[model samples]
Target chain A: MEDTGTRSFVERLLQLDRRWIFLGIALAVVVPFLVPGFKMRSGVVSPRTQSIYDTINGLPAQSVVMFAFDYGPASIPEMQPMAVALCKHAMSRDLRVIGVAIHPQGPLLGGQALREAAEEYGKQDGVDYVNLGYKPGGAAAIKGIGTNIYKVFPTDLSGRNSATLAVMQGVRTYDNIDFIVALSSTPAPFSWIAFAHEAYGAKMGVGVTAVMATDFYPYLQTDQIVGLINGLKGAAEYEDLIRHPSYGMLGMSAQSVAHLWIILTVIIGNIAFFMWRARTRG
Target chain B: MEPGEAVATGMYYLSGPVIGTGVAVLLTLAIYSFLYADNPVYKFAEHLFVGVSAAYGVAITYHMAVLPLIIDPLFRPQNTPSGQPQYWVIIPALLGLMMFSRFFRRYDWMSRWPIAFMMGIGAGLAIPATVQTSLLPHLYSTMQPLAPMAEGRLDLLTGIDNLLLLVGVVCVLIYFYFSLEHKGVFGVASRVGIWFLMIAFGAGFGNTVMARISLLIGRVQFLRFDVPEIFFPPSP
Candidate 1:
C-alpha cells in the first residue's frame, strides 16, 4: 500500500490555509490597537537613542536645524511619528526648522506633519519653519545641503522664496545646521554619516528601519549619529521618553500583542516539531 | 487648475480604479496569511508585492535619478530652468551613466570608473569613521550600569553588554576574516560567534515580520474604509 500517512503530512504541508494564520495575526495586532495598554515594559535602550534625544533636548531656541525627509509613503507611519515628534520638540524649544525633502513625495508627507504639529505648538510657518521641497541626486543633494541649504531649494513648498523667509537667513550648510534628523525606510541617505558627518562636520541623528539598525549601531557607538532610533521599537521608546502618547505608543500597545502572539506561535510550532520527530523515531 | 494639474488629476483617477481598493485589501490580508502556511491568496499577494516593488524601483530611478538630473540637464540644456551647469553637473551625470553600463556584459568594464569613485569615497568614509563611530564609542558605551554606577566607573550593564557586543564583533569578524582556516580555539570562538550572529539574525527576523505586518495593517485600513463600505465607516 502507498504510505498514506506521509502523503497526508506532505499534503497538509502543501495545502495549509494561510488565511487562518493571517486571521490570528490580525487579531493579535488589531486587538492591541483597540485596547491600548501603554504597558512600558523595560527592555534594552541603545545608547544611540539616548544621545539623539539628549542632543535635541539640549538645543537652544532659534537654533536652525536642517530636517531631511528622505523617506516616502511606505515609511509614513513609522518614520513620521518621530519626524513629527522632532518638529514638535524643535518648535517647542523655539528652534528654527528648515525642512528639505530628498524624495519628491517627502516634502508633502513631512509638510502635512509639520503643519499639524505646528498648529498644535501654535507656531507660524515662515517665521518658525520652512519646507524646502525635494532635490535630485543622493549624495549631491547632501553635498548641496552641506554647502548651502538655500541654494539647493530657493523656494519653500508653499512657493515662498528662501531668501524672503527670516527663518532661512542664518541657516546655510552643515555649519549653520545645529542638528540634522532624518527618518528612512531603506537606509535613506545612508551616506549622510560618510558624506555629511565625515567629509563635512554635521552632527547627525536618524530613525531607520529596524533591519538597518544593527548595521548602524557600530556607527552609533562611534558617535557618527548623535542619536539613533531603530525601527518602530525605538520610535516607541523615544515617544515614551518625550511623554507623548502619540502613534508610537498606541502602536506599541498594538505591537506587543502581536509580538506575544508570534512568540506563542513559535513555541507551539517548536513543540509540534519535537512531537513529530519523536513519533517518527518511535 | 492648470493643464498640468488637470493631467495629474486624471492620472490619479486612472491609478486606483474603483475595484482596486477592495482587491488590494483582500490581497494584503491574504499575503499576511502566509505566516500560517503557503496558500494561493498569500502567493498572489506576494507576487503582486514583488511586481509592484520592482515597478516602483524602476519608476523611482527614472523619475528621481535619471530624468530630473541627467536627461533634462543635458539634452535640453537650453530649457534648463535652474540656470547654468558649468561642467560640474556633467561629471556627476557621466558617472551616473557609467553605472548603467555595469548591466551590459560586453560593456561592463566601462562601469569601473563610477564604481571606483563610489568605492574610493566608500573606503575614504570607512577608515576614520568606522574607528571613531563603530569601534571606540561602542567600546566606551558598553561600560554602562548593568545596575547603578560605582563611585569611579560602574559598568555593570554597560560592561557586560559591551563585552557581549565586543565578543560578537570579534568572532563575527573572524568568521569573515578568512585569512586562515577555522580550527582549534579560533574555530571554537568562530562557532560561538556564529551563535551570537544567529541570535542577531533571529532578532532581525522578528523585526522584519513586524515591519511587513505594519505595512499590511496600513493596506487593510485603506481597504476597510476606502473600499465598498466594510465594517469601519470612514474615519471622522
Candidate 2:
C-alpha cells in the first residue's frame, strides 16, 4: 500500500501540468522587479568584452568608428543596450560616430541609439555623428564602403548629402575609420569580417545574441574579430564598464531568478522521471 | 484644477506615443496569453505581428533600397550627388526585376540567369575570403606550441589547454570520418568526440535559454515601467 502511494505520487509529479512551470517563470521574473533596489551581482568583465572597451577607450578623439546595426526589433532587448552603450561610450570620448545598417529595420534602431546618445552628450548631428542608413547588399555594401562610402551611402538618414556632412569630411573609406563594430543578431559579422576586415584590413568587433555567440568563438580566437559582446550579459557588462546602469542592469536580477527557476524545474522533472523508472523496473 | 485644464489633461493623455504604447501593451498581453493556453487572442496577436512586420519590411525596402538605388539614381537624377543620371543603375535594376520571372512557370528559366549571376559573384567573393579569413587562420591558431616555456619555465596550464584543444579537434574530425568503420581505438575516439559534441550542444542550449529569458524580461519591463510611464509622464 505504501509502494502504491509512492508510485502514485511519482506519477503525479511526472505528469505535472506545464502551465505550472510557466506560472513559476512569470513569478520568478516579476518578483525580482517588485523588490526595491534588487540587482544581481555584477559579473566579472570577460576578456572579449574588455577587449572591445579597451579598443574604444584607446581611440583618439574625433577618430571615426562605424557601428553596423545588423539586427532588428526582435533583438531589441539584447542588441539595443549594446548599441546605446557603444554610442554613449564613443560619443563621451568625443569620437566621431557613423551609423549604418545591413538589416532592413536596423536604421531605425541605430538612429534611435545615435540620437539618444548624441542628445545626452550634447553632440550635434552632421558634425559629431551621422547615420548612413540601410543599404540593400549585405557583404557587397560593406565592400563598397571599403572603396568609397559616399557611393554606398550618398546621403545621411535625414537626406543630408554625404559630402556636405562635417562627420564625413575626412572619412572616405574604411581606411579612415578607426574601428568597426557589427552589432548583429545574424551572421552579418562574418560578412563584415570577410569584406571589411579580411579584404580591406579594417579592425572589427562584433556584438551578437547569446545563441550566435558560440559561432564567433573561432573568429575571436583567430583575431579576425577584436572582441565579442554576447547577448544581455555582454550588454550588462558594457553598462558596468561605462558606469551607466540602464535596461541591461535592470534585467539581471530577473534573469538570475528565472535561471534559478528553470534549474529547479529541470531537477524536479528529472527526479520524478528517475523515481517512476525505478518503480517500473522493480 | 479648472474644467478647461482637466479637458487639456485628457487630450494630453491621448497623445501619439501614449496611444501607441497602449496599443503595444495590448498586443504584448495578447501574445503572452499563449503561455496560459492556445487561444484566439494569441492567434490574433500572432497574425497581426506577421502582417505588421511584412508591411514594415515592404515600406523600408522601398524607402531604403528601391527609391535610393533604382528610382532616384536612374530617373530622379537631381537627387544624385553628381546631379546626373546613373544609366548604369538600370543593369542591376533589370537583374532585380528578373527575380520576378520565378512567379511564372514558363519564364522561371529567366530567373536562373540573375540567380546564377548572384551565385557567381557571391562564390567569387566568398571562396577566397573564407579561405583567408576562416580556414587558414583557424588552422594556424590550432597548430600552436602545446608546451611553451615562459621565461625558461614550462607553462603547464597553457600546454594542457592546447593539448586538449588539439585532441578535441582531431577526435571530432574522426567522428565525422565515415570512410572507415568505427572499432577499437577509433571507436573510443569517436565516443570522445560524441561527448565533446554533447557538451557543445549543452552549452548552446543553455545560452538559448538565457536569450529567451532576457526577451521575457524585456516584455516584463515594458509592462512594469513603460506602461506606467505612458500614464504618468515624468516631469522634465
Candidate 3:
C-alpha cells in the first residue's frame, strides 16, 4: 500500500546520516565566500546598533572613551567585529581611547583592535590610545578601576607606567570617561552595570554575544545601558551604520544562507514526522 | 623586522603567517572531524586546546596579577615612603595566600575563610546594586502604559502591542503565583501564559541558532579567505 511506502520513506528520512546535514551546512557557509564578486548587502540597522552609533557620533572630539574587551580567543569570531567597528568609529571621531580587560585574553584582543584602527587613522599610540591591559579580579577590579584606576592598573600592557602615557595624563577614574563600552562574552557587562554604572553613574554601552542578548533587554528598556550591540547581526548593523562594510557585513550572507538551510531542514523534519504519525493512525 | 614591533627580533619567525595559518587549519579540520565520528584526531585537538588555555591562564595570572598586585607593590620603594613596610596590603596578601591551602588535605579548611570573605563581600556589594539597577528598574519598565497612548491620542498598533505585553506579563506572573489554584479563568490565563513563554523561548532559540551559524561562517571564512590571503598573498 501507498501508506507503507510513505512510512518507510519517512523512516529513512528520519534515519538519514547527520553527516549529510553537516556537509550541507559546510556548503552553505563556504560557497558564499568562494564565489567570485560575491558582495553581501548590509542588513537593516537595528535600534541597538543605531543607538551605539548615535552615542559615539554625538560625542565631542578628543573625548575619552573606555573600551573593556572582556572576551577571549573563543569569542573572537563574534566579538572582534564589534570591537573593530567600535575602534574604527571612535578613532574616526578623534576620540582618545583607554582599553582594559578583566579577562586574560582581552588585552591582546583589545590591543589588536586599537592597533588596526590606529594604523588606519595614522594615530600615535601613547597620545591617541593606551591599552591598560588585563587586570585580575572581575567585579572587584571593575569597582577598583571606577574608584582609582592608577592603583588598579599601575602599568600598561607593555610595562610602561600608565601615568606616563599621554592619554592617561588627566584620566583617572570612571568620572573622567565620557562613555564606557564593555565588549564582553560573559557576565562582565552585568558586573559593570552593577559595580561601575551604579556607583560612578558611568554611561555604559554593551556588545554581548547573541545567546546573552535577550537577558539584557530589560536593562536597555530601563536606560541602564545607553547602547547595545548583540552578536554578528549587531556587528553587521554597526558596520552598516558607520558606512563601512567590514568582516561583520561580509559574513552576513553566509549566515543568511545557513539560516535558510536550517529552517528548511526543520520544515522537512516536521512534515516527515506528521506524515509518519498519519500513517500509524491509519 | 621593525625595531619597535611587539615581537622580539629572535622570535620573529614564531609570528609568521605560515605557522599560524597551518596550525589553525589543522586544528579546525581536526575538530570538525567530530561530524564524521568521535576519533583520536578530535580528542587530540580538544586536549591540546584545553592544555594550552590552562597554561596560558596560569602565566597571565602570575604576570598580570601576582607581580603587580602583591610582589611589586610590597617590594617597590615608593610604596613605602618610610623604611617601614606598608601593612595595608598585608591583609589582602594574607587572605590571597590562604586561598592556596586547598591544595593540602589537612589544611583545606583554611581555604574556606578566604572563600567566605570573598563571597560575603561580593554579596554585600551586589545585593543593593542589583535591587537598584535590575530589580526596581525592571519592575518599573514592565509597568508601562497599558493602553499605549501616543501624543494624547489612541494608536491602534501601539495599543495592541502594549495590551499584549501587559497581558503576557500579568498571565506569566499569575501562572507562577502558587497561592492561586488552577481553576476557572485562572487555568485559561495560565495556559495563555504558557504560549507566551514558548514564544519567548522560541525567539531565544532562533537567536542562538543565528549566533552559532555566525561562528561556523567565521571559521569557514578563515579557511577560505584569511588563511589563503596570509599564506598565499596575491601579487601586486
Q: Which model is ahead, 1 or 3, in terms of DockQ?
A: 3
Off by over 4 Å in 1: A1-19, A33-50, A154-160, A241-244, A278-282, B1-166, B177-181, B220-236
* TM-score (all chains, Cα) for each model: 0.73, 0.96, 0.93
Tens digits of lDDT, candidate 2, B1-236: 55346445687566687789989999999999998899999999999999999999999999999998889888998887888888998898899899999999999998999999999999988899889889999999999789889999999999998998998999999999999988899999999999989999999998899899989989998899988877776543
Candidate 2, residue B138: the lDDT equals: 95
Return the top candidate by lDDT: 2
Docking class of 3: medium
Model 3: per-residue lDDT, tens digit, A68-127? Answer: 999998877789999999999999999999999998889989999999999999988889
Model 1 chain B scores worst on lDDT over the 10 consecutive residues at B227-236
Docking level for model 1: incorrect
Q: Is the docking of candidate 2 incorrect, acceptable, medium or high quality?
A: medium
Best of the two (1, 3) by TM-score: 3
- Sort by DockQ, best first: 2, 3, 1
Instruction: Please tell me which model should have the higher DockQ, number 2 or number 3.
Output: 2
Cα lDDT tens digits for candidate 3, B1-236: 56224233334335666688889999999999998899999999999999999999999888888776666667864532233445577788899989999999999899999999999988988898789879888888777675667798878797777788789998998889889797789989998998999999988998898788888878987887788776654433
Every model's DockQ: 0.19, 0.77, 0.54
- Each prediction's RMSD over C-alphas, in Å, is 6.5, 2.0, 3.4
Backbone clashes for every candidate come to 8, 0, 0
Provide a comma-separated list of chain B TM-scores, one per candidate. Answer: 0.57, 0.93, 0.85
